[model samples]
Structures are given as C-alpha cells and as structure tokens.
Target chain A: MKSLDIWNRTYSRAFLDDLPHRWQRRAFLRATVKTATVIALAPLVSSLPGCSDQRSTSPPLSQAPWPTLAAVQEILLPHDAFGPGAADIRATPYLHALLQTSDFDPEERQFILDGAHRLDDICQEQHQRAFLMLDPALRDPLLRDLAESRVGDRWLGALLTYILEAMLGDPVYGGNPNGIGWRWLEHTPGFPRPSKGLFHA
Target chain B: MTDHYDVCIIGSGAGGGPVALTLAQAGYRVLVLEKGPWLKTSDYFKDEIACCRRSTYTPNLRDERHVIEEREGKNWKAQSTYDSGWDFWNGNVVGGSTNFMSGFFFRLKPQDFQLRSEFGPIKNANVADWPISYSQLEPYYTQVETEVGISGRVVAHPFAEPRSTAEFPYPPTAEHLLSRVFDHACEQLKLHAIPTPRAVLSRPVDERRACEYAGYCGSYGCATGAKGSARVALLDRAIKTGQCEIRPHAQVQRLISDDSGRVTAAEYVDTVNNIQRVRAKIFVVACQAVETARLLLLSTGPKHPQGLGNRYQQVGKNLIFSAGGSGRGEFEYADFSTDQAQALKQIGPFVNRSLQEWYFINEKQLGGKRKGGTIDFLLRHPNPISRAVGLRRDDNDELIWGQALKQRLKNEFTRAQYLDYEVFCDWLPTDDCFVSLDSAVKDKWGKPVAKIRLNSHPQDVIIGTYLSNQAKTVLTAMGAKNISGSASTSPPQNLMAGGCRFGTDPKSSVLDSDCRMHNATNLFVTDGSFMPTGGSVPFTWTIYANAFRVAEIIKHQL
Candidate 1:
C-alpha cells in the first residue's frame, strides 16, 4: 500500500494534467484520503513562506546539456524567506553527481535529459520565449502545466525527486551547502555521520 | 583449513553464523557460502539513500529477479516489484539482512510454541504446535544473550514469557526524551510500556565496541560494532578461530546427493561463474525461509524429484510473514503546554518502549481472547531526504511544485517531531500464502526464479486493525495532535518465516523437529524455516536462539 500511495502521488500525479475532469476527480480522491488520515492532526499548512529571499545565487549552468534547467530549478523551489532553495544550494551539481555515481536507472536519466530539452520547446511554443527568459508569473504556470502534461510528467517527477535529495541529503555532496538545508528545516541529523570514507571511495 | 569441511553452511546470518562458530570451536573445518559480497566494516556508512537506493547491501533486482505473484482470484497475477510493488527483502550481503535489522528482540512466549494446542485452530489457517518447547530453548537464549550481546532493562511484562535470567546483560541505553512522554501516556492509559530489549550492545563487550548512540543505527550498518550483527558478533569471531572459511560470491545452485538420499556435495557458480562443487560431511541450510525453501525446491535430483526433501511435497508450504501496521504521530513544539515539549530532543536513537499487554488479548468482541502481537514505538529515522518526499501533496490534494512545494517542506521539517508506531501481529499461515518456482521468470543465471504467492489471511487484517487502533490510543494519550493509522493487508516482507515448517507428521511438514529433512538425513535447515508457527514478534531473536539450540543438537551428531 505504501508502494501504491507513492506510485499514485509520485508518478501518476505528473500525468493527471491533460484530463482536467479526471484530474479533479484524482485531486478530490487524494484530498479525501489525506483528510481521513490527518483529520485529528493540526490543519494543513496555512500559507507558504514569501518567495523572494535570494541571498546566494549560483552562476548560470553553462556546461549543462540543458542550461535553462538552472532557471527551472529556481522555479521548482525558488528562494523563500525561510531559507535557501534549489539554485542557492546548487542542486543541479548534486543531482548530476547522484545520477552519475549512484545506481540510477539509465532510462530515468534519459527521460530527465529528454524532458529538459522538451520543456524548453514547450515553453518557447507556449510563451514565445525560452524557459529561462520567461517572466516569473508566466514561468510558474508553464512549469505547473508541464508537471500535469504526460509529455513532461515523468521527467519533471524525477527532477523533483532529485531536487529533494539535494535539499535534504548530506552536505558532503555538493548540494545542501554549509548545512544550509538542514538549518532551514531545523532537522537534527542522526549521529555517526556518513563520511566519504565508505561512500564513493 | 582443508578444502573440504565437516559442515557447509549456506547462509551467514543468525542461523548459519552460530553453527559455524560452534562447529569451528568443536574443531571441525567449516565452509560458509554467502551469495552476497563481503561488505567489510570499512564499508559501513550512514548514507541512507546510497545504502537503500543503491541496493548497497541487497540484491540488484534487474539481474536477481523474483516474480512475486499476488492472489487475484482463482488465478494469480505476477506483480511488478520494480514499477508497482515490493520484492521480498532478502538481505543479500555477507552478514545477510541481519546487518540492516532494527534489532528489536522479543522472546516467543510459551503459547507461541504450542499455538495449535493453546488457541486451537483458525479457519483456513495452518497453525501448528512446535516439536520443541520454550524450556528446551531457554538455556540457549541465555547463551545467545551472553555470547552475542543484547541491551535493555527487563521489567515485568504481562505478556513477557518466563525467563531464567534476572535481567539483560546490559542496562538499556540512555532513554530518548520521548521515552518519558510515552511512559506517561501508557501510565494514563493503563497499558504496560516496558523497555524494548534490543540486540544492540549498550556498553563495550569483549572485543566489540559499545553503542555510540549513532542516530543512523536502524537501516544502516553500525560504524561502531555496537549492534550485534552476525558479521561482527559471530562470523568475525569464527574467522579468528582459523577453522571457518567464509567464501563470498559462491552462489549455490544445486545440492547433489547419492541414491541413499544423504547429501554429498553442493554445486555453486563462483564469482567468475564457474561451477565449483564443495563436499562436506554435513550441510546446514539457513539462507532464510524463502531462499532456503527455494534452494530445496531448486535442487531436484533422481532420488527426490519434487526437490531435496519434497517427497511429502512440503518444501514450501505454510509460509508466514509478520502482519504489520504502522502510524506516525506528529508533535509540534507548540502543541504541548508542558516543558516536556521543549525538552523533546531528537538525538537518542531508540524510543525503547513497547506495550505487550495486547500480545494475547481476550476481548469479547472477538468472541474470545485471541493471539494478538507486539507494538514498538519509535522515533522516525533522522534522515531528512526521504522525509522531504512527504511534501509531494498539498491539502488541496493537487501536486505541489514550485514555491508551494518549498514552503510545505519548510513547514514539515522545522515544525514537527514524530513518533512512529508499528504493530506486528500473526500472519496466520494459510495454504494460499506459499512459494513455488516461477515458470516464466528467470534470474541472471537462467534458473527459474522463486514465485511467491501472497494472499494474507483475513485474521491478519483483523489482528492488525486491532493493534493499530491501540497504537492510536497510546499516541492520543501522548498528546500528539495529528495521528492517523490504517491496518495493512500486506505482510512485512522482511519478517518472513515458516515456508519450510517442522513437525512429526511427514504428510504436512517439511523438516523434522531437529530441523533435519524427513526424507534427506544429512541435510539440516536451521533458519526461521524450521518454525511451525512464528510467534507474534520479531523472528530474529528466536531464529538466533533456535539456531544456537539446534547447533548443540547438530554438535552431538558430529
């Protein structure tokens, strides 16, 4: 059931966009399931943090196969007053390293790579500009559409997973720089911290 | 050590480790064939995703595949372990899955030993009495504790089986701040919350180090040799004796026996995929229940066509897995008026609290008191990355991306500390739940893979629901604001047992009381495979203890 829940919310959620009627049904179902589980708990998060607190910004990724992804990373988890977002943490490097070194599926890697290229085309056709050059209000809705559309769902879904890894994984990797992510979350990491001694070595 | 051994052990976890140690001490040369790699202590790390995601200590399923078929009606449908569901969690490394276990040890009560006699029979379930009693195994449990090392206080538990020893070898590790809250909650509810005895060393024992309270302890291997993993606790010591040889990467495919039906040699594909046969005077099959049964079902020969000990066709019958249901209760700092909320530090690893009062419940709603199970309350694993995945959905039920996703992550991580509770109930062995060789699927070696058929008995769902409800009550008492739990129809894959059951009746059971095959004389199965009915508890301690007892019996034969 954990697997089904994860599959539905994680993978299937990306494809629900094309069918707005079916999407509403799924969203209602998701809400009903969640409400049943958390009814006794505190109400859902009231409002998100303010979206503009950019203390540190990574240089635009030049070497990347899809350079506009640097901007997409910001769009996905942009700088908020609470703390650093994906770009500030340089999530792309960590995600790239993870995809390269870890036991990543080749198919997933290809999907993400293809998705990056496809997303640019989608944005250009829809908004008459590349994803990176689009305005923030215009930029956000297009990305949300990509998440819903089947064309970019799997790729965007996987991208979100890797981005989360960057934000919360050990700072030893390039992401979560200076323990910024941990500090933001106020998460006290478990002891006997993992070292490079056994990891990639 | 000679090329050939007095005994060849097929696994390296709780079952095979003790036998290797004891037989080596008795001056017999022993060979241990572990299919997985020898991940040395130097390989131990606290990287959760690397260890979990990389299949670091488990089977890389693309090559080592299993066609897990769930019951869909009259016919069975093979579920995708990759895209859809789970594969059977076989700890594929040298120490086996024991290295990754949470180490919650609870002795099986006497009633568990004689479940058929005690509780009678349930409809369609294969509950049976064990050939050996708890008294027969008590001395060895003490031996296992003293030798292997265990920590935690043993207060009077209403459901705790009688013990010969006064207390555990080591006192409980320093309590987490949540311990006090849990205890207080249980006190108000009038449920017994005793210390959860663990197979972890609280203090330094012999050559092994003590618990460093490494918060990354549960799923990850111990960087410090505090948790009593088979490698550090047994095989490491067995290697020192110079009589035991651990041959990693030797995948045993077939067990060859003579016309008289006694085992002769084991043919295995070595690291470079060479068919290497090693002869031993005796052989012990302890590669867990599923694989042990798989090995037996795979080794088909002229003498025993149904596979090694399947003359009675009971090689893989009455499979049991622990029925599991869990709930997480989130406690934000502001939820409590008491200073206990502020003091709830997230450092110490073990919640170390369990309520066994419901282990054998007699509620009238069930018509009578039925055999229930154990519940362990735990602090959620401290890793932040996996927790971040919890933010995928928003209250509106729409997928959260962009700024909304960012803020949801912030709210979850900074705002709350959670107590996770898991209830382990009896997975009543019904004929529907068993293992067979998958005709369609094959592994990397082109051998037919094990086909696991799982349709859990309705009783499991009933017992799981009851325990989960009880867990909610305890959480409610603890002042948790958001608490939600649901009973699971699925079984905990890791806690599998009873595929190769032991009994006097040749018609119904696979192995005999001593875990020896009824048809094959020289073969012995010392894993959880020998269990007729796994009690409502973690099977590791019992598997270890029973293996120790069986080792002594095998000792007399040698």
Candidate 2:
C-alpha cells in the first residue's frame, strides 16, 4: 500500500483506540487527528514513487516512528569507542515517554513523527530501502544530508536536545539509568532528587 | 463575604512578606493573596529538568504571557513571550522570584538615594533622587539581616554602604578555593575584594536549616529553606501568630474602590476559578514591578477613572531592569597540579567575592564622574543538561554528531572548571521603557496582559562595558585562559523594579514617600515599584528593607 493510505488507515484506528471514552465522543478531536495526519504526510506522499501494490508490512502508525527515530539517534550519538551513546542512555525510550505526556506540546510530537517519516522517504529515494533496512555505514551520510535542509536540521537538533536530556536528566525520567551517563561524565548530581511521584508533577 | 482583614496584601514575595509579618505580629488580621501555588521547602529539589527545562515554578507561557516589544533598528517589533519562548515569568510560587534568587545581596549606597544630585543626569535618562533617604531605610536593612537572615563577614571597602550593624547577623557561608585566588588577584590589582553577602543562612535559624551548599542556588528553589525566600523567612513566621492568612492560587483581578477613592475590597479569582471578594481597611499591591503596574491599570474605579494612582499616567512609566553582561573563563585541570586541580573541581561551596572598585567611576578616560556598577564572581552553574545542550553546535554552527560530539562532550565534562563574572549596572529609566496593558493579548483569565517596551539607555552599555572590562582584568590576574567579556543591552528579567516609582510630586509619581498611592490614600505599593531609581545591584535586598520600612508606616496608620 502507499505510505499515505497506510498512515491514514493505521493512524486513525490506532489513535482512536488510544483515546479515552470521553475524548472519543469529541468529533473535533477525531477530525483534528485525521486532518493533522493528512497535512503532515502530504509532502512525503507526493515525493514517494508508486508502491501501492507492494505488500504493506509497515508496523502500526503508533510504533512505526520509533524504529526510525531510534536508528537516527544511534547514528547521531553512536556507540563506538565513546562510552555511552543514545541507545545506552535510553534516549529513544525517554523521548517516547516524553511524547506520551499530556503536557508535551502536540505540535512538537507531530513534528517528531513527521520527521521520522520524511527521513524514511529520503532513505528510499537515495537508496531503495527504509531507514531501518539501511547499512550501518550509510546511516550517518544520510543524516548529514538531512541536516543540510532547514527542517531536517531543526528535527535533528530537536532529537539531539532530547538525547542530551536523556543523557543528563534525572534517572527518574527514564533515561540515564543507574546514572550511567553521569558516571561516565564524572558529573555529581545534587541531593534530594525528585521522587517518582514528582516526575513532571 | 469573607471575614474582614485589616490589610489585604496581593503578593507574597520580598515586597509583601515583611508587611504581612509585621502587621500580623502587631495583632492585626492580614490576608495575603498569592497568584501561584504555595510550594514549601519540601516541594523543592535540584532537578535540572524541573528547574531549567520546564516551567515548574512559573506559569505556563501559553496561559499567562507578556508582550515584549523590542527595537529592531528604527522600528519596534512586538512578540508574545509564548511565541518567542522567552520566559518573562519569574518564580510564580508563593515566594515569587526570591525563591530562585542566588541570594547575592548588596545594599544601595548613600549616593544611590541622591542619584540626580550626585551624578548629573545623562541625556535621555530619568535620574531622580529618592523621596526617602538611605538613613530612613538603614535600620530596616539591618533588621532584614537578622529577620531575613543575611550571611557574610563585613569588610570595609571604598564603596561599602554604611551598615548599622558591624557584622552580618550570621557569618559568611563556606567559601570555595577559588575565593582565595580571587582575593589574591584583587590584592595584586589593588582592588578591594569584598566578601559578597548572601541572603542564605549560614547556621540554623529557628525552624529553618542552614545552607546545604548544593551548587544549584540560582534558578532552583531552596530545598532547605536557607535561601531566605519570602515564604520561609517571613510568611511562615506570620502564620504562627494566627493573624495572617496566606491564600495561594488566589490571583487578584483588581482592587475595588469606593467613590471616596479608598480601596474597599480586593476582587480575586480563586483556584477553582470562583470570583471571591474580601473587605480590607487597607490594600497593598506588591506583585513585582510589571504585574504590580498591570494590576493597578486593570483596576478602574469611578473616582480614579484611568486606574488607581494613574491620574498622571505614572503607574507604569519607569520600568527598569538591571542592564549588564556576564562572562566566563575556563580553568583547565592540565595547567594545575593534582591538588590544585582537585581543589578547583570542588563543587557546592561558593566563590564569595565581589568587586565594587568601579562603583563610582571617576576616570577621565571614559567620562568624568560617571556611575559604575558591581562585579560578582562565582562558579558556573552545574546544570549538566544546559552545558551539554550548549555544545551541540560547532564553531561553524553546524551539528556535530556521532564521535565528534561524544568526544567534545567528554572533553568538556572532564577538562576544566569555568568561573563566571556578572556585571550589574543601572538600567537607566527612560520614556521608552515602560509597562502597559496589551490591547489585544489577554491572559488565561481573559484579562489584558502586561505589554513591556524594552529600550535600554545607551550610557548603560558604556558603564556596563567599563565594569565588564574591569572584571576581565581580575580574571586575567587569576590566570584564567580564553577570557572574553562584553556589555549587553539585553535586560536581566529577574532584577526588575521601578514601574510605579515614588516621588514627592503627585503629578510625576504614582506613590508618595510612604509608598501609599498619592490619590488613593488607602492603597499602597510596597514592592520594588516604589524605587524611583534602582541602584546598581540586586533589588531583593532593597525591596526587603523598604517593605519593612513601609510596614512600620502602615502600622502607625492602622
């Protein structure tokens, strides 16, 4: 199936299912999700080649963005000779948790999801595969090319911002587990850290 | 209707704390209406995410925002704080911005009270002598040292204001090893390195504990109630008397007044969005400078049509912020021995040193007899997230990811300690910089929000640059590498005052010397709003002292 068709069908069903019963009754909210999805994906859909007849094996809309984002984060702060990278610091999970928050800006959440889709499209255009299917060496060059564009640069910067948060933020926020990032950097955290109850309270 | 209060104070920061405490102690029922939540010391911690990244202690910009108008070339551009992400809201908790202050306290020198007399006026600056002299507020400053808990060892410097007390109520908080180096550098340069006084407690004072030296003083609420915020030092004590009621999340909409031009009641929106009214013999507005002026302008009464105390259009005419720049120098570990490097890396303790050598610039090179400023030296804050975020871009402003970024982070983390200097100077009051209500933009309550026009006086930069250059010399003397500093036109949002300035002439000023509204006799503005000319230092100490001074005046009136 085409990317837009898959996104429309998968996202609408998945998002509606996630909403509370009270929220489900709000027609404007459902309309907003559908409208947002179409607006966010229109450019990517137009850029992609015809692949509607291809077997649709993409993950559900909710889970589709994470693997690409995680791949991008690993390339951004790869686990090479350096001590701890994005994966080691649990950046992707932290980002996922942040996006799930009620207080998190919805526009920013959509931007992150849209940016992931855009990255996949670029990967397919440059090399005939999804971002997750790319060779490890090819990922960095693709991200560098993405960084050349204004939106891509901002998206990467946003991801880096979250990665830094994961690396340095309190472990209670789900990143820097066991203070591994802190220990590596020789940073001494102040006392009286927030309890789990006060995580963004 | 609620029980009648002798006084209704509409803020709980440094401005309102003393009035509430003093009135309640004198057997009067005082009600304090604070716009934000009442977060105790137990609710505070040193979480970087909460303190720096999120608007935990302040209002969300989307709900309550300001319209900041800045000059872009010859034209002015207005942008909402929500769009710019430039947070104008300081600490909105019960204690206000004082909760997050670094507690670097300084008293206004005697000359500051007579700025117009001492230093002749600059071209476009509205320099005016204070209506009240320093002598009138001296005793109160001394009182704040004991009651509000200032900690420092007094040393005679050329520019040290005459203190009523020989020494601070509490001895200075523990100092870092860098202080010694700073002192030595100052000695070599023939400069008087005064031990910077802090509002933080050095030892246990009643229920409050001493400083924990958490290296996260600025921008973070005090976890130990040692920073001497208004809530901990004053309001908490007032509650013990059973005469003071602190109603948090009670955002006052306006002061309701009678035709006789006396404030009869304060109308506020409660936490549940219910409109509540309470009668009081006297009403005090101490909501800092910008919001204080906004409150008065919003309160339109029959007797005072334009707004209470705004008959002459002087309610928000002279908004001032501290105009200065900050610089940092790195102390590399490789340059020092292991012991020295270890001492350099030591955290928590403060670099309690300041230089007021240029407080009065008599140099002929710049200009003869110009007012200068204060230079405070300290350690760079240890917020690792902020530090890491700053390093995301390379010298060319390109994203540096993967191995390059990781190595950069590692090097920055382990390499050297950074010492910083902050230059605080007068943001000269002018016709251009003032607070007014935005015509279109409304707050979450559907009331017009504060619109601030920021235009700094050119001479402020000249003085700030002079002071910053002097600071760089001391840093160079301390053997710091890559020393760079400059003066900026950007205003420090935290150190603000002088919207509703007090003066003798009713036509030119909002309040009289007693801080009571000139036309509306029963209404008083006890915050930094009463400052006609804010001195070249932090305003908290002055605000605390003046509030204590005003409280005594209110006591006699009652």
Candidate 3:
C-alpha cells in the first residue's frame, strides 16, 4: 500500500484525539503496531535522499557528430530489455561534459576523445559501418581489438575503462539515470551519505 | 584594516581552536584568523555532488586540483599537493579538517614517542624520538577527553601503552550487525578487537548531544553538534571570552617580520573586501599540514630569504599520511543490509605485538620490541549505484542470464562482509618532498600558491604491502573470497606527516619538544606538522593533547 493509504487507515490524528481515556490505552497499542510496520519498510523509503528531486529527464543530445562515441557506448552497454538505449540515456553527453570541465586532467580528456575517434575509424575500415551500426558479434570483436590488441594507442584500454566507469557511476553525475542499470539488475539505489563513509556491512 | 592582539593564531580547527579558547580564557588578547569562510552546520548537506565531487571542502579549484607528474630528476611528486587529498573530503571552512572528520580519537602509545629507543632504525626512514612521553601527556589527554567527551572502552591490549585512566565518558559505539560479524571473525583468530575510540558522543555529555547514528559523520558537519569539532566544542568559548577574536576569511599572506627577525605583524587579505594587518607579540601556525607549511614558506624577510624557518632546508620535510586498505568477506548466513541501523560499526587500532620489526626510528634503536598501526574495518555501505558498479565475484562464475544474475547478486550481497584497514606509520622526512613557492600558481587573492612536493619512501610501500597481505589473512580465516586492494602508491600520499617536525634540537627541527619553534622564540606549532613520528592512533587526539600541553607551556612561560 502507498504510505498515504496506510497512514489514512491506522494513523488518523483525529481518531486518537477522540478516543476515551480508558480506550486510549488500546489506541496506543494499535498505533504502535502501525508505526512498527511503517518503520520496517523505512529502509526502502528513507534510503532515498534527493531522489524525489531527480524527477526531470536529461537535456537533449542534439549537437555535433557524436555518432561514433554513441555507437561504442551502446555496443558496450546495450539498451537493456527494461531500460533506455545507451545514447538515449545521456551517458555520452555526461562524458562529454566531464571531459570538457576543468576538474578532469587535460591529458585524460584528450586521450578519451582521441580514442573514440580512433575506435570508430578501425570499425569503419573493418566492416564499412559505424561501430553502433555493426552487429554485436562484429562490434565486440572490433572493440576488443582496439582495446587490447597492441593498437598503437597505449591509452586505448584506459579510455575504454574510463568510459565504462562513467557510464556506471551514480546518476547524480548524469549517467545511469533513474537507476536503469540498477533496475536491470534488480538493485535498489540506496541514497548514501558520503560523510558517513560506507554504511555498516 | 584590522587591529593588533597579544597572540595571533592561524587556522581555526583542531589545533587552533583549543589554544585560542585556553589562551583567551586565561586572559590573553588573541586573534584567530581562518582562511576559509564560516559555514553554518545546517548549510552542510549530504550531497556527494556539491561537496565531494566539486571539492567544496578546499574549493578555489584553480589552486587545489593536483596532477601526478614525473619530474626529470625527482620521481612522481604531488604536482599540486596542497589539495590532492582535498578531493577525498576535508573541511576547509573554520573547523578545518575536524568539520569532516569521523571524530576517532586515540592517544599515542608510550612506545610511539621513543621509536628510536624501542625499535631499531631501518634504512631510509627518519623516525625520531618524541621529546615528550605518553606519561607526560596523559593528564592533558584526559583533559582533552573530558572537554571533547570521547566515547570508548579502554581495554588493555598487550601492545598498547599503559594508561593511568579510568573508563571513557560513554561506552563504545554499539556493535552494529557488521561489527558483530567482524568481532566474531577476529575472536576466532585471537586478534584483539578493541573498542574504537570516537569523538562522537555515545551518550549526551556536556552541551554536546548524543550521536543519532545518522551515518553522516565523515564528510559533513554534524547538524546536532554530536561530533566533537572545534566549531561546536570550543570556538564559541574563545569568542565569548572577549579576549579572542576570530576573523573568518582573513587569509594571512605573510608574516611581517622586523629586521631583527621577530614576527611583528601578519598581513592578510580579507575575503570580504579589504586588505588587513594584525600585529601580535606571538603567532601560532595551527593551520594543518599543507597550509601551515605554505604560510611559513611564504613569510620571507631580508634576514630570512629562504623563508622564516627554512634556514636548515628542513621546513617542509617528513610529510606523512595515514594509509588505508579494504577487504571483503562472503558468508552463507549473512544479509549485509538486513540490520540497517548497525551499518556504522567500526573495528579498531588493534595490537600486533610481533610487527615491531616493520617500523623505523631515527635515534637509538628501540630495545623493547612491539609495534602496530591502527587497523579499521568499516562495513561497506554500498548504495544501490555503488553496489551495481563494483558488485562482482570471480568463481569462473557461470553467467546466469538477466534476471537470474540479478537474483544471484542479491543473494550474495545478503551474505557478504567487508573490512577496511587504516595504517598510520612514520613516513621518512625527505628534503625533496617539501614545499616551495610556485610563482606561476596564484590563489584567488593573488598570493603565491604553495607547490607541494611529496613522495613516499620504499619502506612505506613495504609496510603497505605487509598490511594488505595481513588483512587478507584475517579475512581468509573468516571465509571471505576475492579480497584485494593496495595502499595507493601514486600522486597523492594518503598518510602525510612531518612537515615542520618537532624535535629536541632547534637547528635541525622547526619546534622544540614543547612544539615551540626555536629561532622564532614566540611561535609554536601543535598540529600534525609538529608530529615527530605518526603513531598508529589517529592524529586528532594527539593534536588536541599537544595543544593543551602547549597552551599550558605558553601560560607558564609568558
């Protein structure tokens, strides 16, 4: 039941106020049972911090030629059966913004952008198709070749790892919106307070 | 723009706040200048984005973002060291690091002071004997303990220093579900699992309230004033005394010294819109490690061109950082999140009597053999996003498709345990990993920014490796699988110690055993920078103890 429905049923402040002095004891017992039940489900409810504030969808990804980057993201983390596609989910846009920001290392940013371009070139040469346009079988092999097979670019592997991590980071960073990846794996996104460090094991 | 005072204390956190309070209480005209703005407790939030991601604690990003660089002659040094760890979450506001600290407080063991006398000096380490012993500082520790209202159980560990104390103000933090498992595991291995000493009040004591166990103790300021921070505990007392004045956002640029080399006044730029000058009879640099070193290095005069206390080229040497690692366990009957309230449990600076050989001492070798750094195991509080990101197990684990894979993970998570380790050891004092001015790098105030040059010793690496391996052994015995993590040996040194290290000799050390700088007869440093050797115990308690001791010294000497 929704919280409002449950609250309306057993926790009407009016009902308690109207109870006779003798019956007040029984009413308190009834309230205790209801409060305990509400508390037992509190973890699922209270773990969410600022989750209600993240109600809006991401901004549109309509500028520039990000097709190759979008294709790679989809191939690595395909639109799941339950969630939005990789490009449509704002992973690339978020990655673009983080890389462009002053917070990230300049070298790290250049490596990521350059690696994506290099990866798309290899895909086009091998299969005459953009990386996203290729079948999973062909795209997977091509990505592996670029990521590991002594591709002249030493930072290729690192770039791939960075992209993957960015895609998987907390949605508050603009990736993994609405816990799409979490929902796909049946995980509940618990709002953790950082100052508190990690919660108890 | 500002008036003068008898004593001027730079930095308003742990070291600065107390001295300000004590001196003001004793009727000294004092001025406490904090570089950062004052943040109200309510303004502090639990958002990782605004705080952790943006580096809000030490923000002014143009100067704080550090990158690892390989200098041609020196190996990789912290290219911009002042703010490398600032990203992890430290308070830059009036409270200093204490605003974001977990409030874990522990006294140094008696052996920690006489490392040279207890443990033989290892090659490539500058482990020196502390001027004062635990006994001398014991009374002051209790005074701080009462003032701070620490909650802990004082169980005598064989490797611990003997204490002439009673029990803590409150019992240990209740063993949440996680600590019970950790305690059970350690009991089987005979490793003593002592109560973790915390500055968070377990029961309401003094004006401070009891901890709500809200699980927001590390990075954010406690809203309820439960955590014993300088802002909540003592800063108010200092201001109320009317003898002390705290000028927030007053960034001290340089110590204005006369031709005689005595610091007569300090020139500062008030963040609020004015140039300021404050003269004082004495100055105390309690602004924490990096900034404290930076301030001293920036203060140059005709008599001391190399900076006020850099005559020996030892101003910013001996930097140490408390090191950390993590381990995980998988149990058949564990539901990691079942008991939600117990998620804040922590293990302790337990004893390791046989590990004395792993340490280093600068003076005579220690004859009585026993040493151990603090080991902490905080339960891995994986929110759903963090869980999905790192939730993995290796067993040639059959790839169960879609829904089944989800179910498998949920099941495994319900039955898993994790342990994180914290090791505080002495880092060798190196002249190279010191601070100097980077003329090119300027802060918001146009003052020359500090270039932090820091690197770890090979012995620290060895100790880190040893601790990592030992953590796995304890976890393996508890039937946990896939335990891995290293104490990082990269750009950021996690355990930074020894800049302006304390010693008996004035020529070699910045401060006397009493934390008073020798050449500058009226200055003293009581923060982590004065530590001769980093003990396994956390630095806050020691810093507090020394601050009290130094305050007494100043009271009597003056």
Compare the candidates by lDDT and give the number of the best one. 2
Docking category of candidate 3: incorrect
Winner on DockQ (1 vs 3): 1
- Candidate 2 wrongly placed segments (more than 4 Å): A1-62, A199-201
lDDT of each: 0.75, 0.84, 0.59
Candidate 2 lDDT over residue span B422-446, tens digit each: 9999899999999999999999899
TM-score of 3: 0.74
lDDT of 3 by residue, B447-516 (tens): 6766666556665555555666666676676556667666645423323456888887866788888787
In model 1, the Cα lDDT at residue B319 comes to 84
Candidate 1, residue A137: the lDDT equals 83
Clashing pairs for model 1 are A41-B482, B362-B369
Query: Which 10 successive residues of model 2 chain B have the least lDDT summed?
Result: B54-63
Q: Per-residue lDDT for B281 in model 1?
A: 86
Tens-digit lDDT track of model 2 for A1-201: 234334334434423322221110111110111224234333322322342212122333237888788888888888876689887887876676666554456756786788788778777777889999999888898888767655566678888988998999887666787788899898989878866434223
| Predicted structure with the largest DockQ when compared to the true one | 2
